[model samples]
Every structure is written in C-alpha cells, then in structure tokens.
Target: MGMAAVIYMILSFYISNKRLRYYYRFVSLLAAYGLIMSGTRGAMIVPLGGVAMFILLNKNTRYIVGGAICLLFIYVFFAQTHILDSNRQIHRMRTAFHPEKDASYLVRKANQKRLAEYMVHKPFGEGVGLAGMEGRRFSRRFTTDIPTDSHYVNIWVQFGIVGLCLHIAILLFVIGYSAYLIMFRIQNRELKGMLIAMNCGLWGIMLSAYGNNFFWQYPTGYIVYIFQTFLVLGKSYDKELAEQTKLEPI
Candidate 1:
C-alpha cells in the first residue's frame, strides 16, 4: 500500500523509449490492482492521488484538462456507482466516504476520545514505547491499557501535543519543499513527474494514517523514507545527469 505510488511513479516517469513506456504502463496498472487487493482502504487512494499530481504538474494544458475530465468520470462512474457492489474490498473503501456508517471508524473514534480524556492529565504524554503495542510488550502503563488506532494518535500518546506539532511541521516542510522543487526548480520532465507522484503518494499515506498506524509500519515506513531521500536528492540527480549529458558529446 505505501509502496504502490513509489513503484508506479518511478516506472511511469522513466520512459525513455516506447517499449519501456509500454512496460511501465502495464506494471503501473498492475500496481493499481495491487492497491485494490491490499484491502487497506487509505492505501488504495494513493495511486489516484499520484496521477492527479502528475497531471496537474504537467506542462501540457491539454493533458491537464483531459486528466481532470477522466478523473471526474471515474469518480462519478465507479466511486459513486455500485459496479463493484458485491466486492468486499470495494465496499470497505467506500466506507471512507461515510465514516458514520463504518464500524472500524466508530471504534477508532471511541478509542481516540478515550485517549484524549486520558491525555488531559498527562500533557507531555506517557513517553514512547509506554503505550500501545510497544508499551504492552515492554511493561504496563496507564497509556498501555488504552487502544490507539491511528499513527498520529500513537505519536500524540507517546510524545504529547508538542511532539505532534513538531511531527506535523516536519511533514509539511518536506511536502512543501517537494512541491517547490517540482513547480520551480526541476526542469527534467521525468524527475518532475516522479516528484509530483511522490508528493501525492505521501499525502495519501498521511491522510490514511488517521485510520491506520502506517508511518512506522513495515514496507510503508521503509518505502516512505526511501522516497523522501529520493525527493530531497532529486536535484542532485538532475545536476549529475546534466553533467553527464554535456560530457557525452565530448
């Protein structure tokens, strides 16, 4: 789920030839399938978010318009329709739109409320690993007894409001910086496309994290860190490639 956009973004952007592009297109579609099958509601939206960013950042107005129209149709037809009415995975994802009707959502909400009341006394939190699964594994604490479903909630419980603010600040900075690079600095189409995709992918993960503790979870966490590195170093990669291109004619 976390890696879906990473794979699709990289494959979709590094198109140097028709055959390669065709291959990427095929694999990217497959990644989309993997997202749907993963059954993680929040993760499934990452690809579409990445695609939206790709189109919006594209230099071509025609592509932007066409892509927007295509998205509208998909939302109206598939998301709003009962085409996959019988598919449990699809049904679960649809629950995202109606949290009031979602059992899991209600449970998470109740858990969040309980945690909030508990936090009124401990402003600095109970400290990391003292709550949630880590807390249970290591020892018992007041927080350990409480259930937290969201990653953000986990952070809040462990680090308190201060930690949560700092965490959010860091994320906003990365996302903002990435957008700045794509819109103003990056000249290479491939790099720009990949960065856009990564930005959207990160957004998906963050938004979904409200329901699932994914930031520190396996695969998703690893993929996110790697993509962050890729995004931050993208400018360096561009410079190095440019130098290589200049030397190629020598």
Candidate 2:
C-alpha cells in the first residue's frame, strides 16, 4: 500500500497536462476506498477528509454540487438504509463523539486516567518500554481485559505531557505550513492537487489517531510520515516557484 502511494505521487509529478488532474483524483479515491475497506472506522476518515479538503480548497461550484449529492447518497445508503446495518452505523456515529460511554472508550479512558496518575511525579514519563510493560501488568486496571493500544494514551504515558505537547506542536506546524504553501506558493494545478490530497490524508489519519495508535506504528505510521515529507517538499517547490516568478520580467 505504501509503495502504491509512492508510485501514485511520482506519477502525479510526471503526468501530462491533460491527464494530470485525473491522476491525482483517481489516486485519492483509491486511497479512500482502501481505507474504508480496512474496516477500522477510524481509518475510513482519511479519504472522506481528503475529499472534503479538496472541495473546500477548490471551490468549484459544479464539483461542490456533485460532492453534496454524493454525500447525501452515502448518508442515505449507509446511515438510513439497513443495507449496511443501521444499528452498527448508528453505534459508530455515537461512538465518534461520546467515546467515553462506549466500551472501548471507557477502557481507553480508564487506562489514560491510570497512566496520568502514574506519571505525575515522573515528568519525563515512565520510559517507553515501561508503559507497554505496565499496560500488560495492569491489564486488570482497565474495564476490558485487552491491552491498551491507543496512540494518544500510549504517547502520554511513555513521554509524559511534555513529549506529547512537542508531538502535537509538530503536527500543528505541518498542517499550518502545508496550508500556507498550498494557498500562497503552489500555482501548478497538478502539484496543487497532489498537495491538497496529501493534506487531507494527513488530517484524516491524524484525527483517526485519536482512537488508534497508528501514528507511530506500522504501515499507517509510515504512510503518515511519508505524506508529511511530501508536505515539506511541497513547501520547497513553492519556494522554487517564487524564485522563478521573481526572475520573470513583469
């Protein structure tokens, strides 16, 4: 999956003028579909979030109307009809907001509370391995017997609030910097479209990380890091463009 994404990005760079726009859109849709099939509700957010960002940034009226219709159809088919199991969809929606009331939510809450209590005096955190070991040792501390694996909670427990804050700052910086580049520096439609998709993908994954700890773990983590690297690259591209524009005679 990661390799496919990289290939898609490289292709985006070399695509011809006529086909370039379609290529990025196709890749974005494919990525979104893959995330949805992953069956982790959190993972599904990536594509939808990316599409949302695309629509907002582009502001093309026809695309906006089309997106609205598609969203309506999705809500009807997935949320209204029982084809996708109305009850499960309802539960997922409810869990999105009041995760604390849901079983998994309660377990995470309990683990976080316990971890926070444990970290008060030890500001640097209990060290990385210690928290994982403690999760197993205090398996009984949570409502569920399963081990805690939430990235939000895990990072806090392992790095304390200080490390967590630094992590958050980096994310904020990426997001802000990406937006700045897209808005100000990128004028090429193909590159702009790719960056927009990347930005949305990052946002979706980051939002999903609130529930799962995929940000620094396997496949998803690696994908997110690569996407971030692309954002930085986009910024560099913008700088080059600015320099070129300056050299052109007005």
Candidate 3:
C-alpha cells in the first residue's frame, strides 16, 4: 500500500503529461494518508527514501537543498509541538525513528541475539522450516522457538551465510544497474525519472528488510520482482524509441 503511494508520488513529480499529473498527485496524497494511518514503521521508509532519491537525482541542487530544509523544519516543528498529542497513529509514526522507545524493537533485538547464538553451532542453520514459524508448523523436531523478525536473517537461518550474501548481491546488482541506465543509457526524462524512483523504492525495501519481512511477504514481493524486470526492460525500450525518432521522416 505504501509502495503504491511512493510510485504515484514519483510519477506525479516526474511525468510531464499534465493530463495525468493531477490524478497521480491526488492518488499519491491519498495513499500517503493511508500509509500514515497504518502506522507501520518499516514501511514509512519507502516514501522518505524514495522522495529523497527522486529529488537528488533530478540534478537541481536548489530543489534538493530546499527539500532538505523543508524536511528538517517539519521534523523540528512536529517534535517541538505535540500537534497530534492525542493521535495514536502519529505517535506510532514518531516512534519509528526512536528504536529505544519501541518495545517491539527491543524484543526483536533479543531474538536476533538468540538466533545468532543458535547459528554459532549450526553453520548452515537448522535448514528450511527450522528457524521461523514455518519450523513450528512443519518440523517441530528442529524448531528452537526463536522468532525470525527479519527477511535477511530468515534467509541466513534457512540457507546459511552464503545464501545471505548472494541475496544481498542480487539486490545490489539490480540497484547498481538501474542507476547505470538512469545515468548513461536513458535519454527520456520521464523514463529516467520512473527508473530513479524504482531504484529508490528498491533501496528502501532492502533497508526495511532488516526490520521486517515485508520484502518477501505476499503481494509486496510480487510487486518487487515486477518492478525490477520493468526497469531492466525500460532501458531497451528507451533505445528503441530513440532509434525510431531518428528514422522518422520529419
């Protein structure tokens, strides 16, 4: 849901098709409202990181500097004034940046420590379904009752350190290649902006993976794979369009 907003917001900013900009901007605001109401700490990073990347990549130093100043002002203003004093949702959103104030964060850290100790003996982990809730459901024999709060940790437990490295490498490669396309291969402003937004969104998801399993969970995972493929293919489409423009008899 938050990812949807991030995409719409990026489109609203990048798209020169004025006919569609207003609709996308409206949708982006609505999605952003929903994201704030939901109060998912990890998901919040999607918008923050994505927007920052979008602005920075625009190559307009004034906008980038102004955006940073605006963010700082907003943060300071909200923290100083308890405007949402009675709002549970806003309070929860505020706690996201303060991990020490979050009980769930403390518990997650404890569980991670336990998992680390457990992994000391079993280098390749107890195997699939042995480190998470899956283990409790399918193989009670290997279940150690430790919670797998992070997707990266889950991969480490199920497939070992090697698997974790490979997973991270793949994500990094996608981000790096997309950046290359945006910087060198892509000439179309709209296409480049879309790819930049995708790259930022992916980076946010990767960062959030450390705190939650949203990256591999359900529809989000499906969307991630789709966006990844779309960005890669977008570069080729840009080249074809350029060649067509050249060949056209104007």
Candidate 4:
C-alpha cells in the first residue's frame, strides 16, 4: 500500500545511514507513483490524514500553523475549485468530497439505513457470520439481506449497536494509549520519529476503514497490527534504545 511506502519514506528521513535513507526515499517515490496510478480514493486519505496526525503529534506551533495552511489549500483544491477536474485521477478523487451526489455512496448509505431499522429489534445482532456475505454460507436471515459496505457497518450489522460500541471503544483505547506513550515515554529521537511515522500511517488506515473493508484483510492487516503493536510497546523500545545509547561512544 502507498500508506506503507509513505511511512517508509518518513521513517527513512530519520535514519542515520545517509546512503540507505536515500535509497529508501527513491523506492518510496516509485511506490507513490504506483499509488497515484491506481486511482484509489481511499488510498489518498493516507497522506491527508497522516499529515494531520503528524502535525498534531509534533505539537510545534510553526509546523502546526503551516500544516493548517496546507490542509486548507488541499480542501480548496479538492472541494471548491474545478482547476484539476480535467485530470481523470483528480476528478475521481473529487467525487469523494461530494458523497451526496455519488450513486455508490448513496447506495451504501441507504443500505446502512435499512440495516439500522432491522437492528432495532436485534440488539445483539442475528449472529457472528451474518454481517457480510460470509453469512451466506451460514444462514439466510435479515442480517444477510443487505450488503455492509464498510467494516464498521459490517460489524454493526453483525454485532448490533452494543457490539459496535465495544469494538469502537477498544479501538479508541489502543490509539489513545499508544499516542500518550509516543508523546511522553519514548526517548530515542530517531526511534521516536520512526514510530510516529508508523502511527500516522496506521491512523490513516483506521480512519479509512469506515469506508472500506481492509481492516482485517491481508497485507494491510499485517501492517496495521505490527504498527499498533510497536506503538503500544513503545516503552520497551525506549528502554532498549536508552541502553543502546549508553553503550555508544560520545
């Protein structure tokens, strides 16, 4: 995924090895080009959301202000002006800003509404496998009737409002705790920066899961889990880095 490549680029910037860092940067550029050619709107959120998180984590007044200006420019570019509409890729991305007019988005929303009404009675959901098409092999009930376009929506359909709330709470806790550690517990500047980059990448993927089903899917799942694990275990990393630093000659 381009998000992975972007994370690599960000991490590479913090690498002390100049030649290796440059090599990674070159590879990241090629990977970014591939991402652009793919025309995936969700992938676009990686840079947008990741940059926002990066700014927030930095807590630097000047960088924060600059990031805000950049975000505003992006909003104007994608949501307001038609300057880049001539480009096919940009046109497809702009549609994400106007979900109200997008037929596919409307259908997904309609499906959520339908599921909401059906879920009024089934607080615990129909069953486990009944969320998406996985239930087709298990049961043919009301839960299986509608297509759950997003991972969150799919869980809501399968587990009902209660399970949905629990799922979200766990996710919030993981993200919250990891962020706190990164802000205060980590000591190695290089390791901290790399971890921050990974956190931003994972954050973007988590946010995008609202409109996608890749949270638990292949490739992306491994990246997400590994990043979150590293973030949560940041204190352990800090301890090791501290020891390693102690052994180095001044």
Top-scoring candidate (TM-score) = 4
TM-score of each: 0.87, 0.70, 0.90, 0.91
lDDT of each: 0.73, 0.63, 0.76, 0.80
- Over 4 Å off, model 1: 2-14
Q: How far is candidate 2 from the true structure (C-alpha RMSD, Å)?
A: 5.5
In Å, residue 195's CA in model 4 sits off its true spot by 1.4
**TM-score: the better of candidates 1 and 3:** 3
State in Å the error of residue 36, model 4. 2.5
Error of 3 at 190 (Å): 1.4
Candidate 2's residue-wise lDDT over 78-184, tens digit each? 44554534565444643444455568667767776776666788666655644554455544332223344666666766677788788889997997788888877
Per-model clash counts, in order, read 0, 1, 1, 0
Alpha carbon lDDT at 122, candidate 3: 71
Shift in Å, residue 184, candidate 2: 1.9
lDDT of 1 by residue, 1-250 (tens): 4446345645565557778777766776677777778787766555556557657556777767876886687577555777776889777767665667778878878878888888987777778787676579877877888778778999999999888889988887887788778788887777676777777777767777777776887877887788788888878887887887789965
lDDT of 1 at 32: 70
Cα RMSD, model 4: 2.0
Between candidates 2 and 4, the TM-score winner:
4
lDDT of 4 by residue, 1-250 (tens): 6676657776775688999888878877887778778877767777678778878787557757876787789888989989878999889888888889888889988988888888899888777888777678998877777788788888888788899899889777777787888788887878887888888888778788888877888877787788878888888989987888899999
| Residue-wise C-alpha lDDT for candidate 3, range 24-134, written one tens digit per residue | 889888988998887787787777766666666667676578657766765665455667758888777777767887899999898888778767777666787666776
